[model samples]
Target: MSKIVIGKYEGTIYPEKGGYTGALALGFGPDGKRRRLKRKGRTRSQVLDRLKAAVVDLETGVKSPANYNVGEAVEDWLAKGLRGLDDDTVVNYRSLAGKHVIPLIGKVRLKDLRADDVGEWLDGLAGSLSSRSLRLVHAILKRAIRQAQARDMVIRNVAELVKTPKGTAGRPSRALTLDQARAVLEAAQSSRLHAYVVVSLLTGIRTEEARAMQWDHVVAQADGEAGWRPVTADGFEHEKFAIYVWRSVRAHGDTKTEKSRRTLELPGQAAEALRRHHARQAAQRLRAGEEWRDHGLVFCSTTGRPLDAANVRRAFRLITRKAGIGESWSPRELRHSFVSIMSDSGVPIEAIADLCGHSSPAVTGEVYRHQLRPVITRGAEVADAVFGPGKSA
Candidate 1:
């Protein structure tokens, strides 16, 4: 049995109501504030361990007298502050909070939490999350704390002072070469995602945009007699055989940006695959009869429901494996492959930006231009002419 100290601050051991070992600690906080902390544990050592921490908290005045925890703050922001966000964004924020923030630091009282505590917590996650994901996690905590501060609930947002730790380097993003793109297309021709692969690879449409494509948005023919064609100042037709990228699978069916709503010219491969897919879907609908749910999504399951992203990823991996390509790829990578292929084929960045519905050409150059290998040796020759003979190249 442990001896109880005679001082005003000491730890004591006792039996709880269930006959389990319990610990209680009496301590003096800052400015002679008396504090009593209690805890129950499976063993005497465990109870004493908690009492030690309580003593430390009392000594340092680290235990804030605030009424709320981090979890309450995060949940409040998620429920009230995210009222107008996209469904996917809200889902992602909820997942980040639940998976990272809540379990680790949720119970810490608002005023008790310090920047050092948050820094240490984030530093502990360096091995599990990637740099991009770490940024997102930091953003989530910071936004939640700021929201709480705005309501006068908390005096300070400690999360703002904590820097995001550099997380593990993520997988290097890559795009398929021209030959690999063709191979992927050939393999996908026999798969159910043929239309999706064709549309994404050829048109550079985002996976979200393609996933939300509907039959009404697809325009197979261009109007000739009605003079509805777009013309420049020089009087030239811009494009034909188009699809209106008017919506995505997000909540309320909104695109990523205003420029993301432009029309796209359907290439030959995309049009052919879409035509065949239409026939196949019609047959599937006939077979399903009354069991089919018609949500009017172009790329859907046999039951006519929208395709789940995970299911599509799994299916795409199967296709890539069958094509003798490595299976470490996602559907969104196909758009990158499209951008790379276009850049390599000498398509101007401005034109590619227009085709891909980017807000500006600068973004296209910044993201894809340098990453792509040029098919022509002209630029290399010019560099050689300007910089003398290369010592190694």
Candidate 2:
């Protein structure tokens, strides 16, 4: 063995088995303990090169082991980084990571991962995924790599350098026409989900918000200057009603946003349906007797348990089928229909935004762009009056 010096560190190169091995004593670490670096190669120069690389890795603070891989990093993040998120959200992230990220580049070593590798992975997924899904999966990888970087598991986030490629267009959201909306409302008249459909379609509240509604949140106009009282209040009767959109089925039972915590006056149809629903629920409570689990939610199963999205969806589809519309419709579309009906009635975008609990009209315009009528018919009418009707050339 011969002593070799590289920078301030001292090491020796010696023959081991069929290859040369280099061992270096790098000074004490922050823990006051000696740190050593070792490398093995077929030749002295190769061993020296590896030892130099190791020295650089130690200096740069990127000492991730050669075997630490992207899959491990993603799983680590899924385990730790997703804390405090909703259960459904955590499940969704894990599902996306398992399906798209792990299967594609999970085996790639974190140290060796490159921007080109990430870009190529995204390009490969472009054909199979929608643009939104592509962005979500890309964000998952970038965040996972970021988590690893914070732990010194990798030098940099390679996933951040790669641009998310465009993917296939997703299915565009659809709104029911006036005739269809009317038919759907009429069909819901006989179903148990009548009030659910009416409140969702007319009030533009999220399905989660609708399900989380409590009996206390539903208020009726009070006598004189008293304002309002809960519909469940003794001797309550009123022509006008309103609901406090103060909660949702999301984690912590919070609304989607601060602005989403609003109060909306109920339409005649919604208020009437809710009144009928309350009466029906009383009968249901009597029937269930001791079996009812009184959550006080405005909408619940016959057992008085809060209704889940699957319950709403299944019931909504049956109503849609009875309305002569296809069963492909979802409950979320009722909110879209609310925006559509409002826009078609020439309601201002700002007013519609407020009703939908949007932070701004821009959100309303962008999300429900297809349903909004932005063109001014007055200009055409004025032009027709000024220039008369011109013949086509």
Candidate 3:
């Protein structure tokens, strides 16, 4: 059952919800029949407010065509291709549309949306987001407009013609020095979870990739001539000991990149740590008996599902704190530390990039350049040796 009411200042052509829980629709048309606005409100007050606002805009001749409304356009665009995107990507797009774009410029006509309006929106978004995220937002809007053009709603996408605003510098990353890394590992000695920190710092694998590692990816021992080798194509041979990167878990997507699909030589310490980890994991599996899921992930929950990224981060914080380091550090910093330490050892940039799964040396250079400043200083020391120490010409 529902109640119907006409507003004092504006006439309503549709019924309002009677219950206090759900929303009601207050729609109007010139012919007095429902106009099919296709809009619903979350509350009676919201519906009334929508009606009042629409009336005011119409009276002032400021209302755009029903098809031109930005909110409606976003809804239409979403219906077209939302299924193709990942769950997390779709969630973020919906959030941006609802919280930022819709609240700010939803009333603007799709055809009327100018570069200035988009620019103003982006300007407002500055300082609140990272440069990377702002770029994503710009990309989302541009795609939305392209979707609109495909439907023949707008002649051109103003978002395409507009420049995206620059975003603020995100928090700077600080990698742990060798001493600090040792301290963290020492503190992690009591934790079964130390295996996570060990692999991250030692291998420089991305968090997601590390989360996806399995026991099958590693080869501990091999007989004469048939040295330890990773499983490749359902066959095992004495391949190089470093060729064990082939057997990653079957996640939804491919490995980060073709380049990321690489095998790296683990340090002796890392190899020993992984051996101990495997032993411990086997014991736990034996204890669990039939209760274990046996997903075979090197790092996983007791039930064998992927470990929650948030839980890993929280555990990392605890490990860092016990190591007498500040908790402000992030798990990604461990990867940075790996790159920094290797670069300091005069490892070639390409080699470091390959080990870290970077797409290219350029990508690694951009992110870890500050970490490699010592490399330049070392180069200077080399130059000083060649040129002879500190003497004015």
- The C-alpha TM-scores of every prediction are 0.71, 0.80, 0.66
All candidates' lDDT scores? 0.74, 0.85, 0.67
Q: Candidate 1: minimum summed lDDT over ten consecutive residues — where?
A: 229-238
After TM-score superposition, the amount by which residue 117's alpha carbon in candidate 3 deviates from its true location, in angstroms, is: 2.3
Question: In candidate 2, how many Å is residue 35 off?
Answer: 3.7
Error (Å) of candidate 3 at residue 94 is 5.1
Q: Output the worst ten-in-a-row residue range by lDDT, candidate 2.
A: 378-387
Question: Which model is ahead, 1 or 2, in terms of lDDT?
Answer: 2
lDDT by residue for model 3 over 1-393, one digit each (tens)? 244443434233344474232222436668787543223466656665555545544444443454476667776766776775544467677877777777777778776688899898889888798887788777767877788777666666788888777789988988888778878877887886777787677777777677777766765335554455543322323322332454333335457677778766555455556667767777888887888897778788766666776678888888899999878878879888877776766667777777777788899899898886433222212222322223221
- TM-score of structure candidate 3: 0.66
Clashes of each: 0, 0, 0
lDDT of 2: 0.85
lDDT tens digits, residue span 1-393, model 2: 989998779989999999999999987999999988899999999999988878877877986886889999999999899977865577779999999999999999888899999999999999999999999999999999999989988788988888899999988889988778878888998999999997888788998899899989999887565587788883337766789999998888899999999988876667777989999999999999999999999999998998867778999999999999999999999999877877776667887788888999899999999998753222112212322224121
lDDT, candidate 1, 260-352, per-residue tens = 888876665466667678778889999999989998888999999888877899999998998788899999898888777776766666777
Question: Residue 75 CA error for candidate 3 (Å)?
Answer: 5.4
lDDT of 3: 0.67
